[model samples]
Target chain A: MSDSRPVFFVSDHTGITAELIGKSLLSQFPGQAFTFVSLPFIDSQEKAEIAVRRIEAERARSHLRPLVISTLAEPELRHLIAQTDSLFLDIFPCFLQALETELGCPATPALGLAHGMSDAGQYRARMDAVNYALAADDGLATERYGQADLILVGVSRSGKTPTSLYMAMQYGLRVANYPLTPEDLERTELPECLRTYRSKLRGLSLSAERLAQIRAERRPDSRYASLPNCQAELQAAERMLRAAQIPIIETTQRSVEEIAALLKQSLATA
Target chain B: MSDSRPVFFVSDHTGITAELIGKSLLSQFPGQAFTFVSLPFIDSQEKAEIAVRRIEAERARSHLRPLVISTLAEPELRHLIAQTDSLFLDIFPCFLQALETELGCPATPALGLAHGMSDAGQYRARMDAVNYALAADDGLATERYGQADLILVGVSRSGKTPTSLYMAMQYGLRVANYPLTPEDLERTELPECLRTYRSKLRGLSLSAERLAQIRAERRPDSRYASLPNCQAELQAAERMLRAAQIPIIETTQRSVEEIAALLKQSLATA
Candidate 1:
């Protein structure tokens, strides 16, 4: 009976915050199959009511009350969505009310401000960080290595690119990544560029099985995709990283968000 | 007196979900400074107690009740954080209880599952999307034009790169961007490659003044960065896009997050 339950993430803006919060809750219920639908830009009473009707229809079809997670800021619209038959969780209002009490003032309840251009300078800075990440990706731009906030080293397909990009896109960190080639692994020491940036160096490691699986997707049945090859490269790289006293994070079980957060934490304390 | 309030985002994992929800709420209260700190990886009662102590110390330092937003999954850890000196807003417990009531089962309190690699396929898909975005960026690889989920066209420095990268990084969308050079702008029709992929084309425009300001940061005192030159390029690009009937989004006052959300919305309905 726990199959194909409908879940809706509603928001007046991007619905990303709603989705992130809802996913955290939904992930707790692992066995159930949930179909996620995002209803973004629900700023008006009309849109809110329409979302309610859709949820109702979905509930009627599935014989299960759909879970609705929303971050609606407008009071009237929020109230309308809350009255729906779905199991509603409006993320912002209760928190905002508590925040008003703690701060001793009513919140402004600004719509679309969570992920909007309220601060132009921050927006531009994030864009600049993205460009910096792209330009310095895969050790292509060593000239800007001095400006890097993080330098990730790992074998190919060990998740250096996506983690670097995520760190840049999400937290606006200037991240550069270098892939550990066979030559670099044979040296038994860190690369010269990485040595100068030791303060910023972070290593990403993955299990041999996961590395082989990922590499196989890129190049099927090749020597690079062989499990033995993956094991050798990973073991060598990890040993090199440990010998050089560089911190290593295993990326097999962790998501890119988690890796980026750990990187940020290390940077802050380093 | 509404200055420098302390805020803590506590979570059993990376704290991203807590921070997103908290930021959405705090963005409503502008013009007041808030010192935000994240306490991640608090999976144990000891770490949870340490976080409470930190929050209490911050509250004592600021003479203000700190606002704590958390998505802790463990019952005991959630309880420990909730009973802190700060005004607590735990995001998950009430919602999870409601979900359990609706689903007719108790939810599993899995730590660090929200953004973790619980589903390897989706994670790999996201990494593949990031690689695709990088490969096809700025009209570099046209052979894979058919594979793009979005084709963004804009004049130089019109906020295409970051938005494309965001769509790829956040939503796992394969976004490809092309710059509208002056030669293409002078024409009455869209470029041939774009015309083939017109259904996927999304145009981004900016206020000429803002565009000039952004361009000036890269190349000061150049004709390309001059206000008049930017005004001309933007006008021609806008005219060409309009002639081709491509949907346009103004990036002058929109963050990359906003632009990516709008882009995803358009793609969903298109």
Candidate 2:
């Protein structure tokens, strides 16, 4: 049964690419249930054989063949892992082979290059973006708003902080987040500090139920976590944002990845 | 020339996975240079047509055919994107089709699900981890160290904060980072607060030159950014970590992604 089968994401590098591609692929198969285990840094022949043994043990225990999705670059190691009694899917070779043919140059594939320090400038930018995101979080560093690529505004726990951090880290964008306090929401205008940077402003909106649920996790039995309070704050925030012509992104069900992607798209167009 | 060819990561979702895979594949061909662009949320026919035209425009301007790497789900949209005059490489359909064949189920693919909120528990864990990392930054919240899945220790700008945030955001690991100042380096033993949770410790080390360069960007022409001081601090930090039997990862030319991967591996083993 699909329920009994497990999935292993094997890679010679971080196993991140393998995991991402595998997750997207498996999400297409919603009817099945599977447990996932990631085995990273399996670069050597010995480690590859050990991975094979682990796959075999898992298969024998579950009485079903497991799915092995790998990003292994070394041919010898990939061969060793592919010999196991499972459905082995190696991602790079087929695509890279086609790319090599098109580009008319053989690829010198190596481990640790996927997420390594290949582009020093981009690497530095990502690190700086993370620091900027931290330093300018929650309206503390509104003075540095001029350097911001985007400023995310929302009520508390509406996902401004996480989305800000994700955009900074993933896209290397200088992102700053400002929380719209109840006092600011009470006013019919946007915060004074955010007015000059209106071009960089984006609003995040969350459903009252989800807001209350998330707030309850942080502060239970408080006025802050009450449903009516959340609803009022959200309504005021949306009203102020729409009046100012700042676009609002509803983030009740979207992940930080989706939010960051939409932000990047908007930044490019703007 | 190879430098003229451009690469486009086209996707219906976040385009993160497509970019990651494309970068790794292109990194193998380091002898060449290429420009990279990501076109996300290309889910509809109109957007797909726009992306194709953009690719075509880039190719025409550069006098070199561009590479289009996509994670599009719908066959119709994929066909539209593939008809572009370039090397079109669609990742998910190939792998997902094979997986569907293996599972004996017809795949019902959809958009916006790759990095979407599929598992609520995981989404919550990732959010909590990001908050934990921020709260515990620079040993600010020592009392909360009890809940940390891992603790990173290093000198200033030795790649502690970014790595901690990345581990939290990517893997949902509650990571705390402690910086060893000169005062702590002058002593022969570890800091009093860190003494109790030595088992959860991991050290990050950077080359003195790299450390100085990074610090100089923050505080120029100061003793804190001096190379000699950096060398002394790194030496003392490495010695203390070795004495405490904490594994040190040298991140001279590595990125935060690599550092976090190594930490995850160490955690799995430890």
Candidate 3:
């Protein structure tokens, strides 16, 4: 019988690279049962204990050993997981040790920049680019909006947040977004805050029908969720964006993949 | 002069895979000018045309041939992009053709499977696993959730929606998440909605301090954004999750990659 149990992934940063690397590694073992979990950041011993206990319980139920992949495995975390009778793989420690042996430097604090330009580095860059793109001038994001690689503007539920994040994680672009409010539509002008960064601005527009569907889920009976209201808002927003010469992409029916690709293509050529 | 322009990535789903694949491909050409733009989905031809026009304008300024990579290459989109004097690579068609040749079977429409698992047999198995995980009655997310290969959950601002999408595009996991709301905290119970799925339910918790910081940025002086309220909500939520015996992870102080890794580990062991 296949080992059909699951594995867990805990990390202190983007768990994606590790997940991909882990999955690629596991694909080599077919018919083996596995489970996967991703813990974002375990900076505290208490949280680590909670994670360890959960892993142990899963192991007991599945009757299989669990594998853990992580970058922030403090001693306390290790101790907690060690109590569980499961195989643990701490990726960063092993990587650090290997790098230390090669470079004669202690691996106390992992030096991210020391690693040469790698695929991972490129990924980070892409993430930065998307983060830059999503940032708006309203002091809403982690980084400064002026430094954004691109800016997205749209009405609520037009898929701005997800799109902006996708840009960040996938391509390392710094992205920011501003929701076009009713006031902005009525004024028929871009938000005053967006003017300084107008050159980098891009717009996301969704069909009124689609926007209504999305908003209805969040606010079932509000005028904001009605199709006619959505249509009016969308029309006004589009006109304002066009007057500002901001490029727009409609997200009514396309998949997220398609939208990201289209934006990337447009931005690349731009 | 070195081509040092930033790369952009936008996506409706997780943009990680495209960023990774794009970066991998770009690495083959050193010191090349490149930018990645990921737009999650473009539902309207008019919006696509606007994107194309922006690309043209950018290309005119850069004075170099641009490279465009996209998953969607419908004829209209292709025509719009063709107007730009740049090289375009439509990834999905090529990917689909390659898969068709590899699997020696015709692809057909199927719902709820990863794009990579286009093969009918594998797709069916994956769909079954996902549906089973979703339909699980226990709060434990179960091996099915572990089998999910991807899962996401969090409070409103902990960034679960974006992160789940990033995982799906990058790792092709059938991801799902259930929010930990104030009601859930008050009851100190995992959503009866998630009970049967306990084993598969990984928790996403952000630091109370971080949650306050994030909330403050959005709703500066509201009680919900107050430090005390943030702390209380976080404590209550964490306690509820713990009492319910669910696995929990904090999402503060980590990048997207780290989160993806932790989830991958959990899924592997699940």
* TM-score for each of the candidates: 0.94, 0.94, 0.45
- TM-score, model 1 to reference: 0.94
Q: Candidate 3's residue-wise lDDT over B52-148, tens digit each?
A: 7666776766645555544343556656665666555443443334333433454432221223332345533443433333343222443445445
The docking category that best describes candidate 1 is medium
iRMSD in angstroms, per model: 1.1, 1.3, 11.0
* Rank by lDDT (best first): 2, 1, 3
Q: List where candidate 3 sits over 4 angstroms from the true fold.
A: A1-143, B1-165, B168-262
Better of 1 and 2 by DockQ: 1
The models' CA-based lDDT, in order, is 0.86, 0.90, 0.59
Give me candidate 2's TM-score against the actual structure. Answer: 0.94
All candidates in order of DockQ, best leading: 1, 2, 3
Assess the local accuracy of residue A3 in candidate 2 as a C-alpha lDDT between 0 and 100. Answer: 53
DockQ of structure 1: 0.79
**How good is the docking of model 3, by CAPRI class?**
incorrect
